[model samples]
Target: MTNSEWRMTAKRDKVLSVSAPVPPEQSIAWPRGKGRALLPLANNSDETIRLHLRGEDPDSACQFGFSLPGEANKSSGSVTLELSPGQVLSLPVSITPPPPSLLGLAPQTYHFTFTVINLSQKERAWTVMGRLKSKPIIGPGLLGVTGICLIALFVPLYRFIENRENREDAFSATPAAEASEAGALWPLLNRGVEQSAPQTPQLAPPDLESLTYEAMFKEVGAAYNLDWRMLAAMAYQESYLDPMAVGALQEMGLMQIMPATWNVWAPKAGVSDPFDPYSNLQVSATYQVYLREYFSGKGHPGNKWMLAAYNWGPDNALQVIESGADWGDVPLHVRRYVLKIMQTDSHPVLSDPRLQESVGGVRE
Candidate 1:
């Protein structure tokens, strides 16, 4: 069988399998300004599967981008693709080079890995590897020549200046009387300044629990065209503003997001540390936006369904909605999560003029 059509027989029912052509062992030399490439994937199993794709380049010299099956055409670092049994697909993978200004004199080789995970079986997955070569605008040979010329020009001048300065220092040494006079003048000039200046009291660090993280929440929420208050409320409900809090399911940081969620959305949100307050808030807001769009496409009410999906996974939330049940009919925990956010006293976020306008000035 051709590489594209190679299949592995299923050993058990409800098993999902995937196969892809091995990436070339030799590096794929990407030109400085090139945009992207396509990677073909095939689902060779009896079970339908969801694919969560994530890419990482240690040096971060290039941005990896892809689009999911149901998402808009925009490229992101993380995307979810649904593959039916016996389906073959060609997915576009984009490699965005660093800006010309950021490139160095020497050529750069970026090694990246794209990890594909079956969401249903988190532990089962595969990875594809690729390399990008970015040739420098000014090659190393030219740079070495320039450096040698600069050193040749400055070395004599530096030596002459240094010798002349030493001679001057030897000949123009300050007299003892003059030094003593200068020291006397220093005390006279500074007399009573220390006594006259008022003391400024030191301020203590702000309490972590009381900190609103308002600026970060507002920025992230605005980026996704969401209400800052709702985002703040979600954070408050999730971890009570504690960036280091851990949930029962091992969810970490202020948003209580699982590591799986972090792996997928952190790249898309342009965040490196999910434990950081700002990064956590940004990733959480991005996931909220995705959930909102996904549920809205399924004919569910945007606000309530989005909140439900944020608590329970989108798949479960949609199933409840499809069964003719509204937000009130959701599971107890999810209902409580939605109700808590809706009733939260978000005075701080609501006080902002931009947020006020976005939510029609609603006050709880």
Candidate 2:
């Protein structure tokens, strides 16, 4: 009998296991006005597995479909794929939001399911639930009010500066002796002016060397449905939660994501600032999910390869794996990076509750 395992690649570095006979239901949120999001499904079994997917409601406001590479017929209601042993088939499931006219101003929900059958004809199914919500739009009235507030705040400061300059010009018009007397008073006037000057508010700098962003790391992990400990471990290894940290290779932010990779994932993650703590964590999590999927699809245990790929680049990691080298045989720097992340004493991010539960309260 061939043993079979199933996994779903949702984000970049994350994969959710699917139980046999009946997998647990999963939920996702979709923002309105955005294009369809891609969900990757994989089969990690020794026996060939066939998949059949369909939606719960045919006349629902939302639309569902599948994209299979090399297959001429890509249909929505049903699609079939014969996945070989240890082979992963990426089934792209697309969700089309309902028109604003039909959806109105409220959020909506949609449902779908996928059924899988193995060589022995044992069948199992999994459910996908989605909530469709529209992005908030700023109205012209709010913009106008904000503009008026800015004018009210800055106009007086502008006039105050102008008046001060005019007064200085008048002072220069005084007689030499009067100017000399004025010069004696200049010190007092300068003191007064300095005391009266408005101070610009400054932002407090980030505590880079500290584990202050532990909550943020856990939040991003939960958002991506990943183990928080893994995310924390990676962040601690990369930048110790320092958003301003920069690697020698031009890698930026806490997770040390490459510029090129950030550019590809920023839009998908709704991140405008790569250096923001939340944005950095979000992008890094997404990239990790992709890495997990890619390595798992290639028939390798994703943990070690995923870490190596994150540190040494995906191509290099793949090359090392293809060469049949163990994790110790990987490049020295990559090996060290992977080991550091897997080590618990390296940082305090593992103390978080989510991470503790993920690793089963064990520290290694």
Candidate 3:
């Protein structure tokens, strides 16, 4: 899966009145889902400014060109311009139809973000969105997308409702305990000081040891409210504490993080150096929290589900569950992987004794 639309964020708050495609399709996308139009970029501020402009397509469905002063259409490289007050420049945007593999039955939106920076280095990002709708019974492509959608959407709901009934029955025995357990569903979201904010000032890499993958893991786990020992076990399993480890799937560094995973979480953790021990740990920890939260919402909480989801892709893990598989029915490798990590959860650690109780139990 490519970067989701939610990952695209603006760099600043200043406003720009960027016009949409010439004839905007407010109802549906263009006929063949291909559109070419000039988007207006107007500088409404009072100051005359030198600006640098570039565009990004997380959707990978669009091509961009800039019309500079002496250059009519410049593709590929960013362009520089000096715009006085009330000056307007046009950006040519072309959205090509997405390939069949990129489509999904629940509908997906595509984003093309334009970023502009002034001489003072004040940057801002503006984005345009195109949506793809579901067409069932069209062919195998649509049918396959529908099948994936059912697994992604319906199965999760079924698990959630089923878990709710279980929770109600368990809580029936004790009123006080019920209220307390109910809040576990959103521990970080309900109240977390620095964790909830997506934009974090870059936390400096720890200096204990250049080879200190353990220190990096503990630091990240503490910041994210995870069990440091458990996280360390995951790293030990993935890379054997080797900072330069490379996985068979092209995943890199201490955590063996996939390139796609790094692309999604790097910005959230406010780091760019993929191979740096601390940077790698930050991405892994952040994604772990996301995965845990996602599984919790799907009615599967605790380390077993979280670790299983981490080992196998969450979709595959859920598919196994939706197929009515028990722990014995999980793929042998995944079961062994999760069991090893859980076994290591009780290992002693020196970093923070306070996180001792954070090692989670497997849901029944």
Candidate 4:
């Protein structure tokens, strides 16, 4: 069935045969944070057909989700159902927003591939898109906050300046100060203002911390057969890999290793000082090895999950997995942390030249 208001973004090519044929168009776009649309399909074959429904998005901007019509819950990737011969079905799909970022300087579009599969394993696929419109680098809300601060700062300064000017006028224009024993002559007309040299600020020198730990990262990575860039990205997220850095939670050194974590892992890393670069990286690398294996053994293997486990805690990441939800279910901070690590100089979006030479984190 076709509706007057909605446009058909994609359609299955040829009649529905034993082989699943994918659609020609793989990309679709709409202008908003969230979107809802209906995709209609028909089973034209002579026999009853059981079809599989699956949905996923490109790696570049993957903050999207899909659900069947009237479904109570939307799960990640795929769902299953049966369609009788000559039957027609209307599939309803919805997309969620991408991660929050100041990079919303331009419209952000995400693509989700919707596929319908037959028992033959051939499938019909369409790339559905949801667009998030561009936002100002400094939105009105931030501007309003800045304006409020300026008003607070300037209003008092205005009054202060006025009061000083008035006091000076009173002192110079009137003879009361000259007549008083305690007050001396207020010289206004005969005096010239003295100019003084500006004082050099007494700011303390910043700490000298070694930022290059690439060699150590490579050594640890080769030992574990893991990508060194991923470790470097994690290090950047932790403390920008600053060996001398300290966190509010008393997390010390390059990896911002916590006191409790250090106690459990210090002996294994063979180090006493968390501020030592190699020792700190070694401890972190050891912990990451455990994380990687743990997630891989869970049958949900990926760098994203491992990083999420590291940042959000392994138990929390496991809960998300057990819950059968998508990445959207993760908290914003964890999602952001994972996204930053994945995006490198070669990333389709959010790239930097300096991010090159790293082996892996978020692969393109």
Candidate 5:
């Protein structure tokens, strides 16, 4: 052909066309929902291009969608599309109504052609490339990434500094936890069920007769859901047998009944004396049960930390448990104290002893 005649052929060829997957590729595994197929321009001539999709079937009719990478899509259908040689036109496609049955069926695929039409006189022969990209690669090596990281770190540090400044002026007295005899923080010391604490030498049995222990048992059983043996153990740890015995802190009665605890629970239980041994044991048992429920609900395993909270308070207990401070690491006295509570296995400790009692003392 003459050089001038060559212009039209090159221009026609510049309008690109392709049967996707070529032939023999009938189906394309498209991601569920909306997706796009890339139609790359190949005319090579630096020319403006106009491209559109022309479907073979009547169902394939929609505006030609344009986007970079895999984002271009107008609509999904089987069709032949026309395009300028040096121009790339994206076709939008969607996969709906998942295959009816995979049984005895070959995998499904889709094939389509995109045509690039050169709107202006450009290079001799334009070549187009098609790529189906699901997502664009985000390169962090680019600018602004360092700024994003700095912002993330600064927020938490700012919050911490603000809280510290606020605390300087507001926290004047002994912290809320230590200000009172019935310190809300008293639960921190009770180790509860966590056996991770190091065991201390067991407390010696108290001088009290079995009858006195039994009486202590009945009182705690009547007033609290806690096992009587646990109360008995605490009583031994606190008094050894001295009904009137007091601790170094002057804690009195069974379970080292703290004067603070007495003032708190006595009136609630309608008791006139916090020093009443029966009343004291009963209150302590009730407190233990409350702690058990509280710990179990916070998604923490076991009542160990919960009991510790009872002795110290919730905030202290959370610090110990959440910070991975194993109860075993605490002092021996603390460890032994928690272990004693867990060791009580006698009557009333089994919860519904009737079930065990009926099974000839077999434990569930």
Candidate 6:
């Protein structure tokens, strides 16, 4: 009879799927934990038969052996049985039945005698084998597969729940000190000043300056916390303190605020008319305050660093700060600005009476 004609049966419930051709030698996989199957061997005649089982993965690695029923000694009705990984094989003996031993192992009792062998990496095949004397009682082998399926379904969900609970606890227990410690390596804000008050003494306020211009200064100065003279100086620098001035370079109004910078600061300063001297100065001063805070430092020594930075971007000024050098030690352009202001001017334009009035007066 062909190997396919061989009948195998299990006694207990556990078998998943039985593989007929266990690699190397014939054997079957009874998934671990549950299941058993029986292979029938001899029906009538009893002759010694050979069976072998071997592992299919690695070479000369895993193997097992079994003997069939009624093949004791004289009859020689025994088969060499081997076992491996994928399948199990059962072969019948072709000799006469032997007389029962005094030990009382009826021929059927030795129907299956198998041993498991471990395979090495060098081995490529393995098998499980047994000798069948008479019809072998079989057991179920599919239940082992069911247990594996249940494990796969539950493991991920269990880990997910565990991780969520851990994160919640960590968030609740973190203290302010620990939070600060964690953030110490990464600061919330960089420390530095933006601008410094001019070094040379400011020009004396024009005696009996108009109340309208004074009121305008108060409103603009309050919005930006700026020294009014700085705004006045920048206006003089840009438009010669001319409120109605518009530049050839898209600069407009007193202080010559750029449209882009004006848009960014105007809403916050409550200034609607960008060209209005008071409104423009209010926003411009506030914007200068922003730049001052951005560049100034609590430990930075002088206001000159802020001025130098405004004149020559923060990066260049930072080099001076790091070197602990005075503005005069730096570039001439930057030093010339403060120095020129310090030198008193006797020219008619410097003494003009109508300058501040014209720039500071804003309608509405």
What ranges in model 5 sit over 4 Å off?
1-211, 301-303, 310-315, 345-364
Better of 3 and 4 by lDDT: 3
Across 110-176, the per-residue lDDT of candidate 3 in tens digits comes to 5555656665435644554333332222445446555555555555456556666987787654556
- Please report, as a residue range, the 10-residue window in candidate 4 with the lowest summed lDDT: 19-28
lDDT of 5 by residue, 55-101 (tens): 32122322234433333433333333333435443232332323322
lDDT value for model 5: 0.42
Highest TM-score among the candidates is held by which one?
3
How displaced is residue 14 in candidate 5, in Å?
A: 99
Tens-place lDDT per residue, model 1, 93-151, is 66666744333555566666677787767657677665555556565644655565565
Measured with C-alpha atoms, the lDDT of residue 25 in candidate 3 is 23
Q: Model 2, 1-364: lDDT tens per residue?
A: 1112122312221222232211112112232232222333555655666755554344565565665665443536566666666654334444455543322233344444343333234445554433333322433433555555566546555655565577688764335644454344445445544654433211222333343455555566676766676778887778765554656554666688776687677656655344556666777877777888899998875577887888888998888778887677787888877777767564466664443232211110
Count of backbone collisions in candidate 4: 2
Best-to-worst lDDT order = 1, 3, 4, 2, 5, 6
TM-score of each: 0.40, 0.39, 0.41, 0.37, 0.34, 0.34
Give the residue spans of candidate 3 off by over 4 A: 1-202, 208-211, 345-364
Error of 4 at 140 (Å): 66
Which has the higher lDDT value, candidate number 4 or candidate number 5?
Answer: 4
lDDT minimum window of 10 residues, candidate 3: 355-364
Q: State the lDDT of candidate 4 residue by residue for 293-334, as single tens digits.
A: 899998867677888887888889999888998889999999
Q: Please give the lDDT score for candidate 3.
A: 0.57
Find the 10 residues in a row with the least total lDDT in model 5. Answer: 355-364
Model 5 error, position 275 (Å): 2.0
For each candidate in the order shown, give its overall lDDT on alpha carbons: 0.59, 0.53, 0.57, 0.54, 0.42, 0.40
Misplaced by over 4 Å in model 6 are 1-211, 222-224, 298-302, 311-330, 340-350, 355-364
